[model samples]
Target: MYDHTKQYRCTIIRGKSKKEMDDFLPVYAKVIDEICPCSESEFESLFNNAFIRFLPESDRIKKTMDNHRTEIAGKLFGMYYRADDGIVYESERTQKFLEDNDQPAFFKDICYKMQFPNGTQKVGTTVRQRVADGICIRPIAFVLKVLLIAKQANVFITKREIGYYILNSLDVLQGNASPYEVFEQIVKDQKDGTERTIIVPGKATSYNWQHIKEQLNYLELANLIRFTDDKRVVLNLNELQTIELFAADYDKKPEFDVYSYDLSSLDGRKVFQLDWDYYFSQISAVSDQFATSAEALLFDGTVKDEQKSEGKPKPAVNLTAFGDEGESIVYEYEKKRVSEFNTRLANKVLSLGRTKGIGYDIQSVIAEPGDMAEFVKYIEVKSTKRLTCPDMNDDLWVDTLNVTRNEWIAAQQHGKFYSIFRVYFTRDGIFMFVIANVAEKLNDGRMTAVPMTYRVDFNKSSVDSVIVPQS
Candidate 1:
């Protein structure tokens, strides 16, 4: 797991130790000798091609090279050719990859630190502090690009097709050359000035298709697109309109650059940077929180019949005056019962049943794993007397349930800390069903959302329902 708290402490140093240099320099020299075998004076050109070819065609590598191309290119130039300049560079993405892959650590234990002729210390260059700072590709930006591509083609695109389109387009914009042509140039540029030519080991590819599929799934989670059963995707027209408006406002900003590559270029207009923060803010406002599953309320036994004692006289009450009051009492009773259940688990529960506009019905704090900290849990309790009875003939039979807009919105905001508690009043006892992080489950397609009220739609999907049985 990526520790957000410890990210700042873990950094790369500029210079390499003697042992590191000894180990890495030979590998670098071997690659260069095979590729270019240039004289020491032309080592810079030889080293650049070697280093560029060394990068794997992975998503992380693509992101790193995209953001730090100049820095990376400069470091190679100084490392092999201009020894007087020294070499020091650090980036979080690269450092993390090296650590994970057990590659040589960067910016640690320097054997010798270089100094400039002016007596200035030549420390290593730290790329932008946060990954977000150097982020050129964002999920929303990809979403916009995918939508534009679909619009241009006037057809639904498969995830694979979208991946190919993005990969090809990115190669042109970033590399300023075709994939194969770039690969050929790298090999050709590294000629040894002899009859012999270096043989490139692998085929050149722009991007990995799997990574693009993952990106598509993220867009689906953000509700930017919808997927068909056949894995084809259609742009969410509503989301596209909102994004277009966002693009329009972004274009009016003073900081907007016309020369940048952006999705706006699809319409032959001047490009402008998309406002990531603003786009997310809009998504947050409309997205709803999670809801409970219908299967959680299922019970085995049939509804119990009310039996009257023999020869016992029944007292009748006025249905007109006390009817509303009686219903209110039942409603409060169910809420109190659910609250007590949560309280028994050692969680501090606060009832917001009477508190208007709070969205959730209860607020509680529960200890996280390893007892590191406490997290506030927002719960929207839904009570019903109905039970999901299984039909012997049809396997698809299920109980239908409704979740209001306010409740759903709360789930979206709280995310992991949000849950839906279904308290079912049965003839024998009350049954409790807990569905945590309902919005995330919905986003993952474990649950589906419909208009008016969020529906579990058990008939359409399998439910991983967990029930807390009455003791």
Candidate 2:
């Protein structure tokens, strides 16, 4: 009798007659049913109820059982099988497929390329490659496919609720105890650990559960860590965190805040710049001269006398002090006004340069000194005396320096992301700089003045890196 206890190499028997291979269907059926479940008892019960092994004797009897096994595995586990005389086959799950020696050479090559470069190119490319190489029938469009699978956690719920479950579960899973114990501990920890009764730890790194639940639920479903009783709930802690190998020490590490924001508020969504395109479009439609020439830039002076005298249409620009000024003085004012408008638009353009990658947060920015976190340049306009830069600790001073060398080095080693520029802006064509590099002077009440019309220049020693666009 064949020693069936030994691991099947799946090669020598590849050429066996259909009747010979059909004899092993019972063994394959038993193992598949067993390993599929989390506990042995559950698998045993499921296996016995679902299948009946036939005595291997006549080829007719063997072929009949082989077809039944294929159909059963397919329906139960999304498996498929093909037969050559009496032999049966089915596609294995990814984890099982890796260890299977009998896997087709084509599948083996696909696995090699999928895990190529040791997973560096794994992100955003796996599913596409699988399809392009004909490994899978269709392409997986996003990087989230792997994250979904790893979560072994299937089932979908609202992003907000799912987020709550993952987070609440994560809280419970920490500390020295079984995950079951972690749940009760979290409820206790939340009530007492913080000064506040409701311990709402700041924000997550990228998502807000309320806003992104559908996408998140998709992830939970593919991983198979989903709860059966509460189908909407997430149950797998190890899968949720995407940690393949769990170490007790890893659970002890410090957690960082995730970036999240509510942009619905007026203050949060305020457009700092008015639409100049609309204004120009209106001007262009008025006349050919205005459209083609600089005539559109002219300010209406005729309305000042009639409009000011008759209180009908208000003069285009208000003047607190314009007593009997000559054409030269008026020309200068008009030019200055246009320049000011352009400068304001330029400042707004600079503000858009800030995003999550650059680590600009509305909460932190609103907390910065002097309401000037976005102020890259500052100008002190004095009518009579020349504007002098204040002392290092002066109230009106702004720092336009980057993070200091020592602080930057420390941040590079220990920080999750660099704090490159917490402050930089321009006001009235004067530049103010409070960069992350000036960590020493950040808290100090120091001020400096510099030119506003400056641009970054690159030399051999001072080269600027390429900027990547966010999708």
The candidate that achieves the highest lDDT relative to the unseen native structure = 1
Candidate 2 to native Cα RMSD, angstroms: 32.1
Worst 10 residues of 2 by lDDT: 288-297
Q: What is the C-alpha RMSD of each candidate to the true structure, in Å?
A: 27.0, 32.1
TM-score per model over all chains: 0.26, 0.16
Total clashes in model 2, counting residue pairs 3 or more apart in sequence or in different chains: 46
TM-score of 2: 0.16
Residue 179 of model 2, lDDT score:
32
- Please provide, for model 1 over 1-471, each residue's C-alpha lDDT reduced to its tens digit, 9 standing for 90 to 100: 211111111112222322223233323423332433245454444445545543445523544433222232223212122222232222222322222211111111010111011011121122122121222222234335444444543434445444444322333222123323422332343353222221224622322233344344434422334555665565444233333432232112122122232332333221111221112112122111111112211212111210111332122222222222223443455446545555454435566666767777777665444452345677776554322212235322222245667777888988988887655432234555677899898899766655532356565257577689999
Q: Rate the local accuracy (lDDT) of all candidates.
A: 0.36, 0.26
What tens-digit string does per-residue lDDT give for candidate 2 at 1-471?
A: 111112111000011222222223323434453344334334434433333432323433535544544323332122322222222233343223223211111111221121111111121243224223322100111112322332233323322332342322222212222332323333444457521111235756333332223323222222212333433333233221221221221322221110121123443222211111112112111111101001111211232321123233222221111111112232243245434555432323222122324322211121124554343331111110001122344322221222223333444442322233221111112222223423233335332222223456878777567688999
